[model samples]
Target chain A: DVKVTQSSRYLVKRTGEKVFLECVQDMDHENMFWYRQDPGLGLRLIYFSYDVKMKEKGDIPEGYSVSREKKERFSLILESASTNQTSMYLCASSSGPIYEQYFGPGTRLTVT
Target chain B: DQQVKQNSPSLSVQEGRISILNCDYTNSMFDYFLWYKKYPAEGPTFLISISSIKDKNEDGRFTVFLNKSAKHLSLHIVPSQPGDSAVYFCAASRGARAGNMLTFGGGTRLMVKP
Candidate 1:
């Protein structure tokens, strides 16, 4: 079975602080993605990496950055956490382009 | 401008009834469509998907219908169960290697009653 795991289920950070959200997948998928879920907004893509050392910005990439230094791990970084950035962060992995994506449970971050 | 749209914000249905969720997209280049279900505190999971060439696709109790000309798609859940209560998101993909990203709708919350 495919499994995606996040570093934390919940996280609290102060405003202006740098926060890192980590994700690891066991499936060794070639494509990994980061997304944020907000009320009524659904899942908005933040970033995605098609291969190691490669990254692409998604629709809402202004406040976020991603790193895929390794094949099994992808990390999302918040340079400066803001109140508006407090939301559910999700990580997903897919075996190929435009395929089914397996997701982690998600990390709910709160910026105070 | 939002390319994909889920007009309905929420829907309530009883068990054993059919629940229909609708979605529309403005981009005609979208050749593949998908539906995802998300529960509280969890990431959205892939539910079903359909290609532009096909009008409909079914998986167990879930069915997805696509209308290429109308730029619309809908998800139908037969005999809606309480566990089926969750938020449904509609997504579209353009099918290009460099631009193969899924554009998602806002989402529609569904509540299934026993």
Candidate 2:
């Protein structure tokens, strides 16, 4: 079975603070993704990494950025956290294209 | 624009009954579809999937039916149980082998009453 773990299950930060959410997968997947889930809007992609040091902006990547220094780890960074950035952040990893993605439990961020 | 849509925001079903959750997509380019189940404060988990070539796929008590002509898909859960209560999301992908990126629906909250 594939295991995906996140650094934090819940976090609270003040405005303008720099926040980092970490995700790690054990299956050696090549793809990692970051998403934010909100009520009614569902899950929106923030950023994705196809390989080490490779990143691409998803639909809503303005306030977020990502890092993939290694294959097993992916990090999401908030340059300046705001109240609107408070949402459930999810991390997922897949071995290849169009494959099932294993997701972390999620990090519920609260920017006060 | 919302490419994938789940018109119903929520549904309730009694135990041992059938629960049908529907999804629709506006993009004709989509060739693959998937269903995911999510609990509160948890990430969505992959449930089942179907390709455009197949009209139906079944796993255990879950079955997904796809209508390519209408661009609609439905997930049916038989003998629904209380544990089945969760948010169900429908997602679509344009090219299955090219990339894993997917467009998701808003999701339908299903409550299975005991």
Maximum-TM-score candidate: 2
Report model 2's interface C-alpha RMSD after superposition on the true interface residues: 1.7
Candidate 1 lDDT, B3-108, residue by residue in tens: 9999999999999999999999999888899999998877788999999999999999999999888899999999899999999999988786652678889999
Per residue, candidate 2 scores C-alpha lDDT tens digits across A74-112 of 999999999999999999988886556778999999999
Collision pairs in model 1: none
The TM-score values for the models, in the order shown, are: 0.96, 0.97
Q: Flag regions of model 1 displaced more than 4 Å.
A: none
True-vs-predicted CA distance for residue A94, candidate 2, Å: 0.7
Q: Which window of 10 residues has the lowest lDDT sum in candidate 2 chain A?
A: A94-103
Candidate 1 docking: what grade?
medium
Model 2 has an lDDT value of: 0.92
